[model samples]
Target chain A: MKKLQIIALIFSILFAIIIVQSCKSTSNITESKFGAQLWGENCIRCHNTPSPETFSDTEWDVAVMHMRVRANLTESEAVKIADFLKTAN
Target chain B: MAFGQLYKITKEISNQVNIHKMKNLIILILSFFLILLMNQNVKAQDIQSTDEIQKLKQEIELLSKQNNSYKPGKSQFLLRGYAHSGLQTNNNGFSFVGGSFNPLLIYKQSDRLLFETELEMELVGSAVELGIEYANISYLLSKNITIRAGKMLVPFGIFVPNLHPAWINKFPTAPLGAGHEGILPTNDIGVEIRGGSYLGNLKVNYSFFAVNGGQLNDGMEEPEEAGIIHHGIFPDNNNGKTIGSRIGIFPFSNSSMELGFSAMYGKTGARESDVEDIKALHYAFDISYVKTLSSMSSVLDLKAQYTGVNVSDANYPEHDDPDELYTFDNKSKTWFAQLSLRPALVENPIVRNLEFAIRYSDLLTPEGAEWHVNQSQTDVGINYWFDWRTVVKFSYRIRSGFEGGHSEEPSHGGVEEDGGNSFFIHWAIGF
Candidate 1:
């Protein structure tokens, strides 16, 4: 079991490195992209991410605020998400 | 000479009376003209007031338009839902289960007002049970505060509010002691004040709520052996209200780690006469850490939580005979740890969205209980995310201690026995 776990860990690390290199080489990450990326990365872990156009600016503010506490999101991350959602529509 | 004098007197009297009548007619005509002039003046005043009202209406309409323009987006209505179905096998046999159809509705009534509701329908055997998961209206009081009222998921722990949704839950089943019959209440009808604020490098988030308290249930035949205290979702049986609060802090600016603490306290008794006011207190501490390895293109998430509940000096009196009473240890504790790794950082498109997760949970009942009440479980799962809102999950769960029976009676049925193992596969989607 220990050997298997170690092997799994090593394999994961190698795959991660390759993925990161591929991502860095492919795209330019902007603030909006970063926000969207985080939204896709974190928000989707537990549920589907709602469309930014699904809510108005004020509504997004409230929704993000509620989710921040519920999901244990950082203030900056929540703000970025809020900004993305506001502009997404 | 006498006839001519009489005719002169008659003509003089007639002339005087005619002159008086003419004077009276002139005065009556003048009075009618004065009344008409007064009515014209009143009509002029009415017209002036009507013009003022019209101007006010126009101003109000203009103000409304301005308000609408100031709002950045139009009101939104969203409908989202998920369905879960699976098969499980244990010591009994393999059985097909119809899990649930959960529908959520969110309406943005205005810039400051929002209404959201979720309904859950789960198939238990052949019968379907419907439950309102949460139905609440929230109003933004300010930038940093909001007030919500109605039925809401209890905010006591991280799992209930954050990971309870089928699409988001990493594993097929909930953690031990985190379910509805766990140590703490899962949902409550209440009013809550919640928001987030920044203090220095740390972001603080908080929720404080008051809800209907718990209730006491004792079996009619075996009052002493079956008596148990648990959460109540319906109206309060007594005046006492449960107060719960959770506060979390993220010290890092990058949103990587968070620590939170939650507590609830209230009396749980139907009436003063049935039992001494059984005051229930619950506490939980939780932590979550997430890190993205830029080099590996992988994200790692670690989470853990510890929760406990204590009932103060509980005494159960026999329903038929109040004189006969019994007491039991009214304490319960539970904890869980979980780890998840997403290989999305991998360059391979096929494996990028796949995630592997493992979790362990333990639950304990108070000492000197009527039945054995210690349980531990381990689960390993894999999730494939088609999108943020859609997922396919498969998990293997190994459960020890306690078989199929009532949660209240730990000694009944398969007490102190292995619960066997099961495997489940579910597809969840939300839009």
Candidate 2:
């Protein structure tokens, strides 16, 4: 139907926009640096920033992974955040 | 001739030849001996090299072995949740009520999969009423996609899943129709696909789901409850598939703003019960902005959402008169806007921990339904943060509405303004 086609077209346009912007992003940079920035911006989205020392390194792995699903963080972003947490902790 | 001399000379010649031969033989013998000695020396050096390598390998083994006490376990378990107890005073009287604790269990089966659930237990009268608010298993299908199955908070808006916790909610109560009895359903049984990504600097998240959605309570338990949507986890004989989606966009680099859109569609009537096919459609728009202003030394947080539901015209039995049926344009809408400010960076610790919030909410339902409501409510509150996950909130609410709207139809006289006022004090903590 025409409605379905229009919906598909809108989604395609949105996907194209995302791809174009992703190409311009600094995604190629080191994850540690990106993770550091992500941590500074994201953890406060719902609650306060958790202290790095509050959890063990292994505990952070589970905690951050949970947040990945709960907060809807990207896989790379989760891993990078995990890496930074471990290093900081 | 001198024969004896000649013989002596010949003998001398022979002896000289023999001496030359002996000299060559002795040189050959000495060379052979020197080569043998060099071979022995090389063998000795080889043995020493082999001994040193053996020693090095032993040291390497010793250093390679360690306790390894801190490596990740095969599985992980964490207990997390929030608890709150509150008392409210109305125009009539005050009662110590609404005490509840939500215990969450998270089992990380692996890095790629997890199981979690929350038990919402509340104290009502003298009994503890408990319910499983959500229970689901999630598998990380890929870096950008996650597949989940079980009871989940319907992602119609950000509030239900992300900010309903008492510690995070600025006010003591839910915004006007956003609560359990609100137009929106809290959660449902379903399968969902959800994920998030960074579209350049702009962040995005989305959820798509299929659920066995709400059923119309036509066999009204109460005369007023007719036409109400009962969203329990039960199978509908209609067998219609209910599908929904929510997409959230955050445009700021600081992730301080999010705009969301949502929609859901399905049939609400049960076919086995011989009810006519009735369809329902729902839409919602929500926005949230939370920003820390450096110059002002304060944080400004704002949230707003508008939700609308429309169901096809359907007849429902009147509880008072069993044979009689009624129908109405089944439509409902609800909206709430809340803003809060916190001086988090103030020099004084006590003052910095304080927050002020105000919310305005409005709602409207079908004019014919007993549960119909036409009114708006305003709430103002002050909250003090004990820590990041603990808070004490004091809120006052004023609800004003058109008389005879939610309960019944007005008489010959046009509806008059009606409402109520209440105050609440609550303490919430998360662990």
Candidate 3:
């Protein structure tokens, strides 16, 4: 019985060590992940870091048009921006 | 070996935990600094926006002040016209008085330059005429000298060339053509030099004129024989030249208590009624006193005038008799007196215009003549000023003159029983 207890204890220790290592590696990866593609290039210019659901589609439409003039958007770009605004909110 | 390995692993785990806590502390501090920086940045942005709004408000105020400086100065335009239609009933028959339309247009280019013209229907059709009632661009030459050119009213007596019955006095029996004799042609279409200087508390105006004479009519274009000639006075434009002067004194601004006197002498044009153009000479003199008394109750105006004319008859070349006294060479004197009042009425809030007035005048023919025919005229009128440039007027007039003794022969004298009454209503709008 004593021998069995010792073996079980060794296995459990190994598992715990593996779990810690994986958790550390995953957290580091999350921190380094680039949000620039989702935010900086598109959303961050008009919106803060808040959720998109904060504004309604109509509100977003007005906000986007107001910014579009300054952004110098072409017709197609403006349409795309409107579509993005509607869906974002 | 197993024990040593276990210790080393545990020790590494402990160090990792410590490092995680330190990382969290660093993140908290950095986040606090970021929040402070963001709050400061937002405050600065708000201040900048406020400054921009104030600057915009100031710019708007400056633009409004610049708009009010481009408006025009003192200017005047005149539109004068009369339209009349009358129905008369009498024991003999019912007659419809012919309607007449007299239209006059006048424009003032400045304080001095004036151009005027008048057109009216006459027995022979339309009589169209134009004259420079007053033309010399006046320069405040001095405190005393006022030199003028371009036609002017011959400063003689109380009447000027343009003083027609349709304008100043609309009394039917008011010795119509008596005021303007061949004596002092009221208008001399010539140049004049004048001076209006103040002496102490008195104001004086003196003017001299050289003019073209021989322009006269009884406010009507019908044949001279068709209308009753007041005091046997007819305009004989047969005059060629005339010189005259006027002197006046004003005691106060509200009251023009003045005495104006003037005289003129000139050669006259031939009479259209006669075949031959004869040599004619004329002399005229006039004097008048005008006073205005203002009281809290009402305002009153009193005026009187006397005029005399001497003319050499054109048809009867050998005779120097004035038309009034055909027997003993030609000479006539016509005179009149008038009083007027304006009773203050309710003040209008919407239109703060001036009040209305009522006036009466008694005009007589040649004085001391066998005929003592005179006119009784009374008028009640209202005047409203919309602005400095526009005015509207309504008036009613009652006159008794044409019905009196208006026999062609002076010896017959006038019959008061034959006199008739006339009533008229007038509306005038002008700018």
Q: Pick the candidate with the highest lDDT.
A: 2
Instruction: Please report the candidate that would top DockQ against the real structure.
Output: 2
* Per-residue alpha-carbon lDDT of candidate 3 for residues B53-85, written as tens digits (9 for 90 to 100): 999989887776665554333344455544333
Lowest summed lDDT over 10 consecutive residues: which window, candidate 1 chain A?
A21-30
Q: What stretches of model 2 exceed 4 Å from their correct place?
A: A1-33, B1-71, B274-276, B403-419
> Per-residue lDDT tens digits of candidate 1, residues B1-431?
89999999988998898889888888889988889998999999999999999999999999999998786554666666677766666677676656778888777777568788888887655677788888998886655566789888888878887776777778767777776666657777889877655453345567778898676554344453443556645877678888877877666655467787777777776665445376677778999888777887888888899998777666655547867766777777889999998876788877987989999988887554553368888999998988766778888888787532335311101111125577767677755
Tens-place lDDT digits, model 2, residues A41-73: 677766766667767777788888888888887
Q: Which stretches in model 3 have alpha-carbon errors above 4 Å?
A: A1-89, B1-148, B151-153, B159-175, B178-188, B215-240, B251-254, B269-296, B312-327, B345-421
User: Residue by residue across A1-89, what tens digits does model 1's lDDT show?
Assistant: 35434534543453344323322311222232477766765565445457787667776776775565445454456677888888896
Cα RMSD (angstroms) for every candidate in the order listed: 19.8, 10.3, 37.3
Complex DockQ, candidate 3: 0.00
Write the residue-wise lDDT of candidate 2 on B96-151 in tens digits. 65667889898899989999998988765667878888999999987777889999
| TM-score, structure 2 vs. true | 0.79
lDDT of 1 at B6: 93
TM-score of each model's B chain?
0.77, 0.80, 0.54
> Which scores better on DockQ, 1 or 2?
2
